[model samples]
Target: MNKTTVPSAPYTRRPPSPPQLPYPIFLNQPRRAGSRAEFVLTPSYDNVDPGQLTAEDLAIITQNQPQLVAPNVSGDWRYEQRREAQRILEFLYIGPHAVIRDHDFLRREGITMIVVARDSRLANRSMASVDRAGGTLGVRCQYIDVEGPRDLIHGFPQTIRDINDHLLSVYRGQMQEMDKNDRLLRKSDPPVRGKVLVTCESGNELAPAIVAAYIMSVFGKDMQSALQFVGLQRFCACFDENTKRLLQSWQDILRARASVARARTPVPGRPVPEAKPKRRLDQLRDHNDDEMGLGECTMDRERFLGRDAFVPFVDITNDNAS
Candidate 1:
C-alpha cells in the first residue's frame, strides 16, 4: 500500500535520431561514438504486481504516459495485477502513437507483442475468451500464446535479449530474401521492428524488466525509448510448461504480424558490432588511502590535493564542504 515517488531529477530528452559522428560506430561498440535512437523497453517478470504502482509513481509516468487498457477490477488488491494490465491496455489504445491495442489486432498493422505466461492454459483460455467476446461485438482479437522455459522468467533480460536478437536475425534474413528477389525490398530494406511483453502469474519477478531495460539502454536513446522498448509484463493467471510450448508454437503468428507489408532492402554496407565500454570502476585501485598517502602510487596515476586540484561535479551540494 505504500507509494514510491518519482526521483526529483528531471528526465533527459533525446534527439530524434542517432547522432552522426566523424567516425563510423559498430553495433557492439564499447562506447557508441554517436547517440542512440529513441525506443521503448519495458520488460517485467512474473512476480511484480502492477496494481501496486503508487500515486507518486503514476504521477511521474503521467508526463508522457500512453493510454493503457486492461480488465476492470474492484478494490481487491490481490487482483491489482490484472487491473493494472487493463490500465496499460487502455493507455496503449488511446495513446498518441498506438494504432492497435489488442494483441490479435496487431496483424492489421506491423506490430507485435511477445507475452510469455507462467500458466499457458490460463493464458490461452483468457485470450480465447477475449477473442470470442470481441467477435460477438464485431471486434476481431487474435492472440498467440508465447511459450518458453520457466527458468526464462528468472533470466528475464537474457531471454528478452535472445528474443530481440532473434527478431533482428529474422528481419535480416527477410531483407536478404527480398534482396534475392530484386524487389522494392532490394532497393531499401527497412529495419525489422517489433515489441515484446512478457508476463507471469504472481507479478513478483523483476529480472526480465531489468535485463530488458539494460539492453534497450545499450541500444536505445532515452528512458521513454526504453519504455517503448517493451510493454508491461503482467503477472496474471498461472500457467505450465505444456501451455508454454503451445504459446511458443505461435511464434510464426507473431512473425506474420510483425512482417513488413512492403519489401525494403537495407543499406548495402554491413553493420559492425560494438565494443564493450570500460567501466570507470575498473580503472580505480583498491588499496587503502593511508597506504598510498606517502605518494607511493604508480607514475601514470595523478594525485589530488586541495580543492584547487580537485574538480567536483557541478551538482555537488555544499561546495564549502569540499
Candidate 2:
C-alpha cells in the first residue's frame, strides 16, 4: 500500500497497424500531362491576357526537350551557350557568376540584362564591368543581394517586376506607338531582342530558385513544376529540400493573394440585385400611400436595409416533435 503501484505502460504493438484503404488522402486533382495544357487565371487577374506562358515565337525553349524551340540550332552554338550561360526561358538564362565576363557569349545570345542573385555580403559591391558589358547592349544590369531564405522570399515581387519590364520593353514600346497612332493599326508582333541571364556564385542553389520563381509567376506553375522546368534545362542547378520549402511558402502566398482578388471581385448581377430590396420597400410604401403610412421620407424608402442583416436559422426539431 505504501508503494504506489506505477501504472503499467500502455501496451505497445510490435508493429503499427496499417490504415484502412477505404478513405484516400487526396481528392479532385487537376490534370498535369498534355502537349498544350491550358490554365485559366482567376476572372479578376485576367483583364488583358486570359492566361500566361513564355512563348518561343516571341523569343522559348523546353528544359528537357532541347529540340522544342530552335530545331536548327547548331550543336557548336549550343555548346557555346551551354559552356557558361544556359537558356532556361525564351529570354532567360542561368549560370555561374563568371559567365558575366564572357561578353562574346552574351553578344551571341543578345543578352540585354544579367541578373546576379548573390548570397554573400560581398555581393553588395557592384560588378561595374558587367554594367559596362550591359551598357554596350544598351541596357542596365540587375544585382540582387539576397543572402538567406527570408530575404529571397521578400525580394520576389521587385525581382519579378524588373525581369518582366526588361523582357517586355519592346512590347511596351509597341503599345506606346499604338497609343500615339490612334487612327491606324500597326503590326501584330514586335521583335523581342531582350534576353536575361541569371547567375549565382555557383549557379546551383539561389540562381535556380530565382529562375523557378520567374517560371512560377509567369506560367502559373506550382513550386515543384517550376523547379523541374528549370532543372531539366540547367542540369547543374541544384534544388535542395530547404529551397523547396522556401518556394512552397512563396506558392502559398501567391495562392492566398489570388483568392483574395477573386473574393473582392463583385459578382456580375450583384450591383443590380442590391437595389432590389430598396425598390421593393419603395413599392410597398406607394401601395400604402392612401392608407396609414409610416411617414418615412424618400431617402429612407429608397435605402436598402440589408447591411449586416442577420437571419437566424429556424429550428425544425419542435415541428417534428409535435
Candidate 3:
C-alpha cells in the first residue's frame, strides 16, 4: 500500500524530447472504449511466429474494428508483404497501449526498427531465399530467422513508434506531476481504487502497464498524488492460444477460490496470523510407513498394541549360561 511511484532509472545519454499529445492512443480508440480493451493479433500456437497474426487471422482485427476490415487473403507474396507492412504501421503508430507495453525499442527513441520476412525460426533460409531472389529488405528490417526473440523482434518493429509516442506523453505528464505535488497530501477513507486491465503477449506487459495504470489511478485529474495503485485484472499472455487458455483457467480458479474465501466465517475473537507461518517442505514429506494425507497412523503398524509391539527382546539364555 506504499503508494509512492518508484524513481525513474538514470541514463547516460541526453534524454530525447517528449512526444506531442493527442498521440497514438488518442488516434486509435479501442473497440471497447469504456474499459479500454486493445486486441492485437499474434501468430497461432503451431506457427513459427508463435504469437503473431497471419493474414488469414485478420478476423480478430476486424472484430475489434468493424469500420476498417482487412482481408484474410493468403498467397501472392507481393500483396502479402505490402499488407504486412501496412499492418505493422497501424500497430506501431495507432494501436493500443498494450502494444506499447509489450514491445521494446518501440518503447524508446532513435533506435532503428526491423521486420524481416523470416522470423527467427527461418532466418538463414529466409535470408538465403531473399539473397537468391534479389529482393530488398528495408535498412530497418533484419532477417532474424530464429524463434522467440526473432519473431518478437519482427512483430516488435511493427509497433515501435506507438510505444515511443506514448512514453514521451507519459514523461511530460510526470514532469508536470512532480512540479505540482498537491495530490499526495490528501488521504481518503478506505483508500480503495477501481481496476484497470493489463494485457500483453507475454508477462512483460504487467510491469509497465501496471505502472502506467497506477500513475493514472493516483493522478486521476490530480497529477500530484503518489499513492500505490493496484490493477484488478492482468491479462499478460493473450497473444498465444495456449496462454489465452491458461489465463482463462487461472481466472476460473481465482473466481472459485475468491468465492470460497469470501464466504468463510471469521473466528469471533481470534486474530488472523499477520504473515503465513514458515514451514519446510521436507517436514511435510511422509516416511515410508506413514499414512498418506489422512495422517492417522503409520501404514503397517498395529493401532491398539502399538506401545507393547515396540518392547525390546530379552537375551535371558545368555545370562543364565554366564
Clashes of each: 61, 1, 16
- 2 or 3, greater by lDDT: 2
lDDT of 1: 0.34
Count steric clashes of candidate 1.
61
Q: Which candidate leads in TM-score?
A: 2
Span of 10 residues, lowest total lDDT, candidate 1: 90-99
What digit string (tens of lDDT, one per residue) describes model 2 on residues 226-291?
665566566556676667777888887777765555455567877622323445654545546535
Which window of ten consecutive residues has the lowest lDDT sum in model 3?
221-230
Give lDDT for model 2. 0.61
Cα RMSDs, all models: 19.6, 14.7, 23.8
* TM-score for each model: 0.27, 0.57, 0.22
- Candidates in order have lDDT scores of 0.34, 0.61, 0.29
Task: Give me the runs in candidate 1 sitting further than 4 Å from their true place.
Answer: 1-103, 106-154, 177-192, 202-322
Q: What's model 3's lDDT at 112?
A: 29
> What's the candidate order when arranged by decreasing lDDT?
2, 1, 3
RMSD of 3: 23.8
